[model samples]
Target: MSDMPPKLAEIVDEFASAPREVVLEMLLEFSDEMPVLPAELRGHEGMEQVPECQTQFFLRAEVQTDQTVTTWFDCPPEAPTTRAFAGILAEGLAGATASEILAVPDDLYNRMGLATAISPLRLRGGTAILGRLKRQVQEQTGTPT
Candidate 1:
């Protein structure tokens, strides 16, 4: 059975606050047809590869939000479903160290911070601001050396 476009539109109306243009545009524009490949008479093949195709709408909406948009755009593929993100300003300056966090380029720092906020269930959450201390510790250093 196929889902009509209007039915999908109804779903979007339900979640009025979400970026509807991005998600709906992606779903409606998706094409289910696959390119036909000739039968191969060779040794056993374990699996057929699925095509990797995603619309630019999601990326465009995210990029357009710009430097002022201090939010994470993507969701983690794995579970522990929900996320909690707070503004960088909201995090407060208490345990933050200037030397480690400030040294990284502004863009990388932003990305790390976003990733951390979006996946607080992961150990790497808001701590992304602490660049060096977050790394895996080595046997010799007992720190992320």
Candidate 2:
């Protein structure tokens, strides 16, 4: 896997080291930790939907002047697994620099051992989330693709 920001790397390591059953549990915990979007950002113009996911998942990312990134996610409570993926990205990548977000490997979830616990389709959704996050980072940072 590529070098990830310290916080995101820590989360990936946590999942990697966890037992199969615990991985799912930890994912759900992340779902619970998912923050609601601030009222002003809710339904904002820049938010984009990830069509690859079975459930509706929308996200918006902002790269600050200092290059730190802030990501916002909207997923229904009923889609705990999808919400968990968003939670992981939001919590892990929040405040991470654009370069750090860009460096994260596309297949980091596989390294986390999540494949053993979640469906292949769900894992694909996770990959889509990361893809969208990276695109937003590049857009905000004005980095050429």
Candidate 3:
């Protein structure tokens, strides 16, 4: 995580050190803390859908003129795991630059020790979320992957 954004690295460290039971509980907490989508994006029609997730999940990421990233995510409250994944990215990667977001390792969820707490499919979905987010940042910023 040496190349990861500072805030994102911090979150990863926190999860990496947590016990399995605590990881699940902390994941739920992240779900609860996820920000609501802005009114303009509430429709979800323009957002990218994360089909890997069991529940409906949509996200949009914008790399701003100032180089800070702003992301939006939409997922049902009942889908705690998926929502947690979205929340973690939304909060952790907030204000990161394209390079910082892209530098995040592909196996980040696993490195966070999430593999033990969540099902493999759920972990895959979380990985997909980060992958898609990074792709968007790359596409928008014209940064080479």
Candidate 4:
């Protein structure tokens, strides 16, 4: 419901020294251990990693219901689309896909003046993946979602 994309951008800016792929990998690893959705619903896992510091993020949402969401994380992009950890969990929000992640222009990195070492994971929830996870729970459970 909020502007989560910009927040994620802030995170990308903060950890400008860690490899964006590494940051994204760590995020997915954590997300899987603690699925953004109900643990009983579905499970999250890392599928693949692409060049340009982009990682493939896959979500098996509604596993019990046969629903799934998969997307990509591009460290740098020409247009720089934004996606917060929270916004990703929003019911209807389709997070980045593998192809989209790979589609990022090679110039994105230089354009953003970001180093390949940028961590991509922000310490604060500026992108707020955790906050988004909590909100997602509330929405799905109807208790806080």
Candidate 5:
């Protein structure tokens, strides 16, 4: 959780302290919190696909003129684990500055204690999600990496 945005660090703290069952439960809870793709971004037109996920995953970010970010994700309900990863991103990164999002460490999931719960392959998907998200923010706002 080092150098994470405040909200994201708080989320990682919760996961880090939770028991295994509680962590998984929190994942589902976050999954439910994930917002639907706004009508404008639906149909996967501008979204980037996360093929690393076993399930279909797509995400995109909008960087406002103020350099704040708004993230979006699309993952079917059936794929709760994958959806939970997107949920974490949607919750953790929303409203962060472009640089804040870009600076998020790639090992965030392991820091959050998710590596012990989810498979390595799934962790790879989560990593990809975060990577693409930061890239999207950087591309939009020209935030220096």
Candidate 6:
């Protein structure tokens, strides 16, 4: 797997190093940490949905003047697992450069050992989330898809 941004790498390491049972607990903690959308984005006007997710998950990425990327997620609280995945991405990739975000491998969740804890379909949701995030980064950075 490709080396991820430092913050993200730390999260992946945390998951990879934990016991299988602990991974679910850690994921739930992340769910609680998922940041709320800013007031301006509350209505989900421009955000794109990850249809692969079992829950209604929407996200948007903004590339700042400094070229750092900020990602926002809108996930229902009841969907803790999906919300946790979004939390991981939001916290891990916040303030990372667009190029850095784009460099993240598509199978990062697998590297984090999530496949053992979640269903294959849930893993697909995580992958879809990463796909949309990367796509937004590419669009913002003028990188060809």
Q: Compare the candidates by lDDT and give the number of the best one.
A: 6
Over the stretch 30-90, how does candidate 5's per-residue lDDT look in tens digits?
A: 8898898889878999889988889999998889889888888999999898899888888
Candidate 4 displacement at residue 94 in angstroms: 12
Give candidate 3 misplaced runs (Cα > 4 Å). none
lDDT of 2 by residue, 1-145 (tens): 4558888899999999999989989999999999998898687557899999999899888888898888899999999999999998888887788999999999989988999999999999989989998998898788998
Q: Order candidates by lDDT, high to low.
A: 6, 3, 2, 5, 4, 1
TM-scores for every candidate against the unseen true structure: 0.17, 0.94, 0.96, 0.24, 0.94, 0.96
Candidate order (TM-score)? 3, 6, 2, 5, 4, 1
lDDT of 4 by residue, 1-145 (tens): 1233343344434434556666555434323433244343233333222222233333322211222223222222221222333232331224522222223232333323333423354322222333333333334334422
What would you estimate as the lDDT of candidate 5? 0.87
Q: Model 1: what TM-score?
A: 0.17
Model 4: lowest-lDDT 10 consecutive positions:
72-81
Per-residue error for 125 in candidate 4, Å, reads: 23
lDDT of 2: 0.89
In model 6, pairs of residues that clash are none
Error of 5 at 73 (Å): 0.4
Q: lDDT (CA) for every model shown?
A: 0.24, 0.89, 0.90, 0.32, 0.87, 0.92
lDDT per residue as tens, model 6, 1-145:
3546899999999999999999999999999999989998899989998999998999999999998988899999999999999999988997788888988989999989999999999999999999999998898889997
Query: After best superposition, candidate 5 residue 85: deviation in angstroms?
Result: 1.0
Native RMSD of candidate 1 (Å): 18.2
Q: Model 3: per-residue lDDT, tens digit, 32-123? A: 99999989899996799988889999988888898888899999999999999988988888888878889999999999999888899998
TM-score between model 3 and native: 0.96
Per-residue lDDT of 2 in model 2: 54
> What does candidate 4 score in Cα RMSD to the true structure?
13.4
